[model samples]
Target: MERKWTFLTSHLTSLNASTRPLNGQTAIVTGASRGIGAAIAVGLARAGAHVVVNYRQNAEMAESVAAICRRHDVRVLTVQADVSNAADVSRLVETTSAHFGAPSILVNNAGVAHTGLLLDMTEEEWDSIMTANLKAPFLCTKAVLPHMIARQYGRIINLSSIWGLAGGSCEVAYSASKGGVIALTKALAKEMGLSGITVNAVAPGAIQTDMLGHLSDEDLAMLAEETPVGRLGTAEDVANAVQFLALPSSSFVTGQVLSPNGGYIT
Candidate 1:
């Protein structure tokens, strides 16, 4: 399904609304030290949900994000965990619960993208992408399902990529991992639907992020020319889509991949 976006001009005015759906809830955002993940963590906090910013490295950046959330008067914590490691994921969830409460909102935004021709890629390269982009979501999702099932409400949003749908010219492994994420989202949504847990994927197209560092100026220009929106997407652009999917208003939506591609593909 197409992702719906509600654009707000400024943060100050947006937070003035009387009703906040996630005011008392807690959200855990993986890989939230920078880029899209950090944007999402801060957005959730602004909506009044306590936030756990999970990072594998970059403790300083994670703490900075947590501090931003604290300034919003929302509780924030930083946990170091590699989502691809089952043991670390378990500890991550436990720490989140102990600090705030069982997090009903989970943003599976942690991922790695490798650039190379499929023929030139090594097995280790393939494994690394799969573990972080696919297995990590599985491990983290499993860690949180029980609490969500007990409470009978939860939102699981995985960050996918337009590359997963259209396939990139030289990024076979990255594309495959995100494709698995889309499949996982669909299957798990059905499994968790009866329990009031909604699972969805957000596929972003050509977003301006550090991961796009490999793209030359010409490549970016070509992408901008290709997108109907006439510009490359920003981290905040993807974060807004995530905020919508995490809301109670999206309860009826699940088993869906919402592509925020700016008409790059239809």
Candidate 2:
């Protein structure tokens, strides 16, 4: 038998307290195997959307996230795609469209980070960072846009970084890539506004994830002290902001960057 999943429009009417605003809509989260991407996928599922968890290589972790969503009695699909590759991105979007309907929400969360001084960084290292962080979102955005335009309803959220706004030493390439993401978000939002598609970016500060483990304890402490919140931000914190942006009520808010940085750059 062919598998069938609920589409967003029809699911809205059947929504209960457990599954509200997003009833029956489909959401695709890239790099959802862990960290912020995992959090966003789970958030969308809890909000009543069938979620597609896209991962590059971490199948086990991705499957775990999908199982968690399934426990909520919602459908979750796992897809593997290197978003920076055009062919993979094409297959990813096509599979998603076949499994669910045209995805109403697309979260461009796939990215790679590298820490090294400009002089020490090799050309290969720089290229990898740029391709994953910058090119990936561009390709994924292009892949989903056609469906969005046809439906005349869509939400696209790009994951940026606080460092993208305020450059960080030893992370020049990562910062540049995220900066490109912010610019992409703004420009695309303007171009697609007439089609009822809203595009935005979120810049997050120091968040509690495996990525933070690489930092020295003293560095982490300093970051906490610098933050007005006096603590590290959680993946949940960023996820919440994304949830709000993905809502239909946020239709009027587009082309803006929501920084969940706890006043770190202000």
Candidate 3:
């Protein structure tokens, strides 16, 4: 039998969404049209959060993700924005606020992945990777800080990469950006600790997502075998981590890199 995205499926239908952990809070999940981002959004919703599904493109897919969230009986909003663009991020947050008051949970999951040699990588490519992966986090974090600061409560979860810790051979730019994200997570956690906002990073190892579209079946199998768990991670696997970080129970867990890479790297 084939596996499916059970987190977003009727499996969650059995849970008591109203009494879930994040009830009544608002969460904004960027790049949530599909894959890990989508999973995180749905997971947050299932936890009873009013979710804003942020997507750069793919309006239809964003709506589909939103529709699933609604099944959990939580409020759902879909906003289209290029988070790397500060103006667009401004609108994204503003729209989320206009509808759901202020977002207490922010999952900075919007990122672009690149796998190529340093010699072959162009300046434009490097900039795009940095802009999307690094700058977007900076922009979104900056935009949401004021509201969170005033309320003295917030959860900021960044989606990093396993390569960010153990650099990938042909993935210089991507590794660099994700490394920056890890650094950002630690530093921001320190800065926000006094303000009741906890910042953390989730570095997922070889998840079975569209991000791995370039890899062949053999390559995926090899990666799975290499993983101690003997299988690749799932978007829900990472989403489960994000959900924990987003909860009030994780208030004391800050400035940490919660890598869900199945022990791919220690």
Best by TM-score: 3
**Total backbone collisions for each predicted model:** 0, 2, 0
lDDT by residue for model 3 over 160-228, one digit each (tens)?
999998999999999999999999999999999899999999999999999999999999999999999
Q: What are the per-residue Cα lDDT tens digits for candidate 1 across 1-266?
A: 12323334344345654346578889999999999999999889888889999999899999998998888888899999999999999999999999888989999999998888999988888888899999999999999999999999999999999988888888899999999999999999999989999999999998999998998999999989999999999988998899989998799999888888889987
lDDT digits (tens) for residues 1-266 of candidate 2: 12334465445555563356787889999999999999999988888889999999999999999998887667899999989999999999999999998899999999988888899999999999999999999999999999999999999999999988888888999999999999999999999999999999999999988878898999999989999989999999999999999988899999999999898887
- Residue 245 shift from truth in candidate 2, angstroms: 0.6
Candidate 3's TM-score: 0.93
lDDT of 1: 0.91
Top lDDT model: 3
**Residue pairs in clash, model 3:** none
Clashes of 1: 0
lDDT of each: 0.91, 0.91, 0.94
After superposing candidate 3, which stretches have Cα over 4 Å from the reference? 1-19
- RMSD values for the candidates in order, in angstroms, are 7.0, 5.7, 7.8
Off by over 4 Å in 2: 1-19
